[model samples]
Target: WRLAEKAAVTLVDRLICDLALDVDRHSVGETYLAHRPRHAGGFEKEAEATQENYGVAPEILTQSQLSSAGLAGPFYGAMTTPIGFGLNPRKYVAGLYKGAFAAGTRFFDRSPVVQINEKGVTTSQGHVKADKVILATNGYSSEDIPDWMAGRYMPAQSTAIVTEPLSDTALEAAGWTSDQMAYDSRRLLHYFRLMPDRRFLFGMRGGVFSSVSTEAVARTKVVSDFREMFPAWAKVGISHAWSGMVCLARGRVPFVGPVPNMPNVLAGFAYHGNGVAMGTFSGQLLADMALERRPALYPAAMHHPARRFPLGRMRRALVPPVYAAYHLSDLRR
Candidate 1:
């Protein structure tokens, strides 16, 4: 938790200090253990560490306070500000690309990379040789890449479902008027947020198998779980459902450094689902490394090369059993 807080603070600092981006950040504080009291002590310890390190003490709210805020209660609560905010990634990326293009950055859309060697990257149309090549492909990396990358990263799928726009009365009934992003404490957790358009975005970690049948089953389960949790909005219809891959390293940490034995080639990936902020920090670090800048910001562990997974190609087959175990554990909890 401390490491994550530090990394998040560092990213926000860099965005404000170096990039001069006017991030529309909000301070809709988060709540933990809102329905469970057994985990209160551990949560209090976490809040204490966060306060000591970041100078922001989290407030422990009671059931009455949570209910007054239109939240389902029987929870041991802790609230921390300057930690919860939502950014429109689409706008951010568009602005970034526009600036990059204005600064002479070229775009080669739809041109898939065919290979990456000591010389440079090879595209389907042609080869573009360069002195330095930075591979930033996360979960969507091509199979033709180096053995180390193929063996080290496991691409897992994450699924989400968003509802149609809800009326104010419906939102109130669901106890979701706060508009704060929230996630529950569970082995296989559920994350949700109230969108600006009054719709709700509910997501969970599943869909590890890429087959159509498996995805359909996972989607059904997610919808069922959402309905079960938000029974007040039982009649709310799902407008969209989607899934995407997330790269996970064997040690469950991101890596940013030179590929062993691959001269002039650097790779950064395996975000473990916290991609937005962590990826931004990684890109900055990679840029510094490319320019031979001194005094890197992140830790040595983050810069270390990722260790390869055993039975690399067959790792995907283990998803079902792994998810089953996690779900079973959640039930036990």
Candidate 2:
């Protein structure tokens, strides 16, 4: 697991450097700042184990140190980890698309795969013959496309809001002027960051259902949480707000291997919402498998296939109660 984690970061680094991609990547740092004292100890233990196992050093900061680090609020303490950075995921993905295109990878836009057999994929546009097909879609996957994908992946909605660029005065007023990406230690976590452009991005985990009405409610809840965390910026104008699905597996691990009974096909999904890096890493692994080349890194932890959820099509019904339980657990702090 430790080696896989290290390799995941290395793979992304190699992709950016080898492809000469400009992704607006930042190497500032990341902090897991906790708001509750009980969570602070867990952070300390994680920092120690992560440093020992992964060789990335982390500093455990006291409450005063957290405030000194330009984060005001009722934080108990924090564990600031090195070698982790922030990047513009859109730019990174666009860069990948351009690089792959330049390398002679043909793309068919709006051609959703309606069927996948041993020979190729059939889309609404037409059928494309291929020696090997890879299913890379995570949250948007259709269960019936391969039938085996059903009940093996769960999609949950996550919402985020970006504020209009904050002025220096507002930054100081809120005491959150750092460019470091940070999140609190809560079961229902809130990940936030002050982007290079000075816009604050705040996101939260929840939303079992996805719909026009549910999205509005999720946006409202995220805004409420953001305001509660940073009261000084409660009146800030929000420039953008949106929601998207993040995939999960019942096993709580990712799956990257051949689709059952499909010899010429491979599928990878269920990143548990940490897709940017892990997805890239999985793509490399799948490519290696397709090419019959030895994989640079493949951990036994992620080698197993994902298990099916109990409720099948009704698996979404299971999320709300689990989310409610997490909410109640978070309230205990």
Candidate 3:
């Protein structure tokens, strides 16, 4: 976890200094708000650990302090960690893409990798042979592409909704005008933030299937949960709603190392939904490994390979029962 913190810090520094990409909707600090009394104690423990380990002081907010922080709901208390930040991901990625192109990185669009081997990869259009290859594909990975990816990663769906820009009066009514990124203390958590444009972005994890009808159902579920969490915005119109897959591993941690039995092939995935900074950090480590150089931040957790999940291709069947248990646990007082 400390290494992950370092990765987040390095990511922020590189974005501001090395890339020099000025983007909007970027702000530091986050609060892990607790909505239940049972969940409040964990915040204090987290704050103490963070401060003691990293010398970074985090504030633990009381119930009254929650209101002062511009969050309105049933939250009991919170731990505001001043480590990470929230940004417009689309803008950040665009800037990164432009910067990489400027740095002479060749990009081949419309070419989906069909196979990967020690020599290189075979894409839909043509085969590109190289001495070393990196399999950075996360949730969209194909099981048969390398055969090693099967049962080693799990793709879970996360849905999000964006409200129409709220008026000052609306924001005041909700008492949630702050722009800090925040998430509740639930196993299946909900992350939200007020963007610079006054739009409220709320996201959650309840999806287990991928289809048109299932997507609609997931959207409805998220919207319902959003309205339930913030009653003041019950009537607010959602301008947009979407869902995407995030990779997960059996070990519940990220893996960034060479593929088993394939020395020239390196793979990195399973960020558990924190693919922004961790993904960038993993890419750097992969590059270092490819060049046979020591990485600046290659922790033991990351170096450890991910074990394959049970039931092989049928592993997705494991989600419903697990989600059901999580839902029941979150409902407990």
Candidate 4:
């Protein structure tokens, strides 16, 4: 922080000397003293060394490479951003996996398997058997289980954006040459950083998003957002806006492993937006559990079978009043 302050003052001096073209000895002396920049961010302290342990950068598997048969669908890419400019470097990454995954295992089970229809009613057709049954649906799941197991899942969204490349002039003006990810502190927070290419990607929570969304809406929000967050980026444009449906548990933790009492069936998902790391973590742990027969899984509040909040019409009626009261309590910024 102290270093940043010193550099900020030096920047102002350079601006006055170059832009204002203040060359006179007396004018230069006065400008140097008066033009020192004040710290807009109250960065008061500095910390020492920190350590990180990052693992492998996993490869992106394609349709042909999958022995398990990849989904036939569209492929997309994006960038994420976190808003806090000077602090919280990893807040964005704190919620992602740079690259991590474990190799898949093959199973040739021929015993018996059970088939449940879309309605979830078990049907007695053909053979009901399999040596093993695994549910590898990672997030974005919606299926009804028994009342006892209903609390074990969810479906939520993750929104992200990517910007067109910035010009050198624009980059200099923004003074964000150091490309690092960032995010801010909010219950529903925004996270972002830069990309391998020169573009920026920012992501945040809270928005009703879908695949049918239009480019106009995405670019409008992103470009308007660019003007506000980065006024110097006048020529920049938004190239894309996309969303991923992530799973969540009530406790905001991953819901992994076998369903409490379900026989032979195993499940792994419920990332809570921190999946890149936790998802793989759960995978490794689950593998270990299956091999060693230790704890098959952890309890998530979402899986807490006993949770009963206001639902249906009651939720519709009670939420507005409670939400309005929350907004009413906000101070005039």
Estimate TM-scores for all models: 0.89, 0.97, 0.96, 0.53
Backbone clashes under 3 angstroms, per model: 1, 0, 0, 16
Each prediction's Cα lDDT score?
A: 0.73, 0.87, 0.85, 0.41
Best prediction by TM-score? 2
The residue ranges of model 1 lying beyond 4 angstroms of the native Cα positions read: 1-29, 33-35, 53-55, 73-81
Once superposed on the true structure, which residue ranges of model 2 sit more than 4 Å away at CA?
none
Of the candidates shown, which would achieve the greatest lDDT relative to the real structure? 2
lDDT of 3 at 10: 69
- Model 2 lDDT at residue 293: 92
Against the true structure, candidate 1 reaches a TM-score of 0.89
Q: Tell me the tens digit of each residue's lDDT in model 2 across 199-279.
A: 999999778677999999999999999999999998999999999999998888889988879999999998887898889
> Candidate order by lDDT, highest to lowest?
2, 3, 1, 4
Off by over 4 Å in 4: 1-129, 136-138, 145-152, 208-211, 214-223, 293-333
| Tens digits of per-residue lDDT for model 3, 230-331 | 999999999999998899999988899988898879999998898887887888788899999998777788777889999999999999899999988988
TM-score order of candidates, top first: 2, 3, 1, 4
Specify the poorest-scoring 10-residue window by lDDT in model 2: 21-30
> Tens-digit lDDT track for model 1 on 1-333?
346535665675566545555544433655554335555546667777778887787766555576566555334553544454655455556656776787898989888887888888888889998788888899887555865676788788888898999998988787767666667767678877776777788888886656788788879988998898888888998999988888888888899888889878888899987677777777777888777786346676776788877776777776678878888866653
* Candidate 4 lDDT, 90-196, residue by residue in tens: 43222222222122334333422234322233323353344334454554333343333343454445667778886666666675554444443223445555554
Give, for candidate 4, the lowest lDDT window spanning 10 residues: 27-36
